[model samples]
Target: MLGILVQLIISWLILRFIAKTSMDVLGYRINTTRLLLCVGLLLFTTMAALLAYALRWWFGERWGMNPSFSLLLLANGIWWNIKSVLFEELIFRGALFYLLIQWLGAKKALWLSAAAFGVYHWFSYEILGQPIPMLVIFLLTATAGLVYGYAYLKTATLYAPIAMHFAWNFTNNFLFSGGQIGKGIFVLLPTDTVQVGYIAFVLVQYLPLVLFFVGNYFLLKRFGKVYVGKQHQAPQL
Candidate 1:
């Protein structure tokens, strides 16, 4: 799509002209060992996300068969989720994140990414200016941004973050039909959907995110540091 193309061009321009580095610094390449690592993390994070949705059921909500479900729609939803995830990862964690690390060091850069990601979601998720949703969304997405940024930093590759992001979003949008995209593999009828008390809601909502964010943060920490693709010296700023 033209939008994605323009974003790619913008990222390249930032790397080429502003960062004074080539795309090589992005480390957007494949290595067998790291690819396997990525795949493993991909499965791990996907299960975490799926289990998070499953927690909704534990709190009394129920799903009905999606009336509009079909193979064509499922395929389309998967592709759409891919593009959406790719768009966010590129915007948040691609070239600009690397440039930030170059200019500000990893700690500050990661915070910037986290803050920007959280605020950006305020607009994208359309909870802008609302108190509760805004606060919650910012905290959730910002924490996610930290994990994502760290993944990119430690691996020196976008693939790690992309796989995790795509896995989580795909589970929400496709498997669980939890997104605004359409009826996914299943749907919750309003009549069947149960609204629980604040305590139950908090447990169901925040607990899974805890598993996801905490799972990723520590597991990746244990994965150790490395370059995922072809070894190259960091671009000297």
Candidate 2:
């Protein structure tokens, strides 16, 4: 965490020196109404996707309960998730991304952000050279980056992208116990107990997330033009 803070501080310095921009370029501050709408839109899309999986995988009497459920741990998970989300958003969709737009246009900058995001996850997941897993992980994270970056570009705010990112992570971490964080609200059944075929397993694991990214991508494309008041004034090129 200290390392992340140091990197963030250094990043801020670069953002100031090279871009002449502050964190505001990431669009953290905006009309409260607009922020809420962004959260609502992204959350619904995210939850609907997860719920589709829950219906197929969890609620079919397949996934069981977590024996140990602690409110204290839940609190800790929430705190950690918030910090991690903010850090990633600031890194990927923050100043450097904004500058990429100035140098390259929104389309090219989005691709760069998407590609960097996909590659960064390789180190984060410690899957540096393994071909198969790295490829799969890259595809997933890169697709996510495109969606989130598109949201940022279209809405002119990080609120849009952050909402979607936080939703997917938080739900996976705290609701389904599917994340690296502590125990969540539910747990998946043991593999031995729940025997799913390879095709079913693949669908259960990846399909919903694909639907989510596709849904949000089009949603952002369709309605991201929305804004309210002058609180989120667009950044000048």
Candidate 3:
């Protein structure tokens, strides 16, 4: 609990500072309400988790897989979900990616930021003592990063990507199993059957990119130009 508290404070302070600095550098004012962004992100993430859970329940029943939920488990699940959303967004969406855009051109920045975010996952594998599987994971994670990077770039707000990141984590961690959601209590597929390094794993990892493409298309249609110049005025909410 102390560790979590420390993480929360450090992440908040660091990201808040970074956000402010990036705003100054880019001359892009924050037009949207931060509270609204937080709420919207929470709602979208909840919806995605519920959708994945419902699907898992349906399939698990068909396949005779037992998925259980209890009060304690539910509490832990929520804690982890919130932790993931807040900390991950602070590092990837809010600070690193935002700074990348300010330093590099937006297009090049996206790839660089995504790679940094994706490769950071190796730390997790090392902690778990799992196989590195560098090549496959890199491609997959990088693809996910691209989708997330593109979203933030287009919206010029951290809200949408943060929400999407939260949703993806919640769904993948506690909803389905294997590539779909994850292998939490709500797991759909038992881990034994799912092999890493297979094409399916790569596809599953990169699935968010497909959503990114769709979101990017709509954003482009609505916004026209993709890059936000320093002199361009921020739109009113």
Candidate 4:
């Protein structure tokens, strides 16, 4: 918790120094329209992920409620996930992203920010002893970062990407329980058995992410113009 606070402070300082603006310039303030858009994206992405899980279950994937599930634990998990994602988004998409865009242009900033995000996951995955290969992990996380980065760019607000990030992480951790390391509150596949195919696992794990990217792309196309060009300017809301 202290670490998260420090990270937030550092992020705010850097963004303030580099962007020459208040924290609100980084899309901290929210209006009704932005609120609705964020909520809609959150629900859409979460539902898409749940749909993928349901499909996997229909195909004989075993799912059981976590016997150890506690409401307190679930609440704590939700708070932790939010804090974790908030710190990440604030640093990667909030501070570093703004600086990179100013120095390297938006195109370069997008990929660089995503790459940085992917690279940073190496230490955590290693510590967790993840079964997936490092390169594969990097690719997967980088892809996710791209989606989040694009969402930030399109909406010109942190709320969209933050909502997407929280939904993706929370759903994977709490609802589906099939993250890269394959642990969750709700088990989608029995880890003890070797019967589950790799393809099936991939579909269950990554399909929603693909849908999120595509779905968000269309959403932005329909509504992004209103928020466009507001990212670098003073807070409008």
The best candidate by lDDT is: 1
Residue 40, model 4, lDDT? 89
TM-score of each: 0.88, 0.82, 0.59, 0.82
lDDT of each: 0.80, 0.74, 0.53, 0.74
By how many angstroms RMSD does model 4 differ from the true structure?
4.6
Superposition TM-score, candidate 3 onto the true structure: 0.59
**Which runs in model 4 stand beyond 4 Å of their true positions?**
127-132, 179-185, 188-202, 226-237
Clashes by residue pair, model 2? none
Q: Per-residue CA lDDT of candidate 4, range 1-237, in tens?
A: 887788768877886786776667468788887899889889988887677767766666677877777787678778878888888898788877877767776667888888988888887667345656777888878877887887777677888889989997888776666454344477654545435678877777677767877887677667653332324422211
**Which sections of candidate 3 miss by over 4 Å?**
1-68, 127-132, 177-237
lDDT of 2 by residue, 112-175 (tens): 8999999999998899879999999999899888877877877778788788887888878777
- Which run of 10 residues does model 4 get worst, by summed lDDT? 228-237
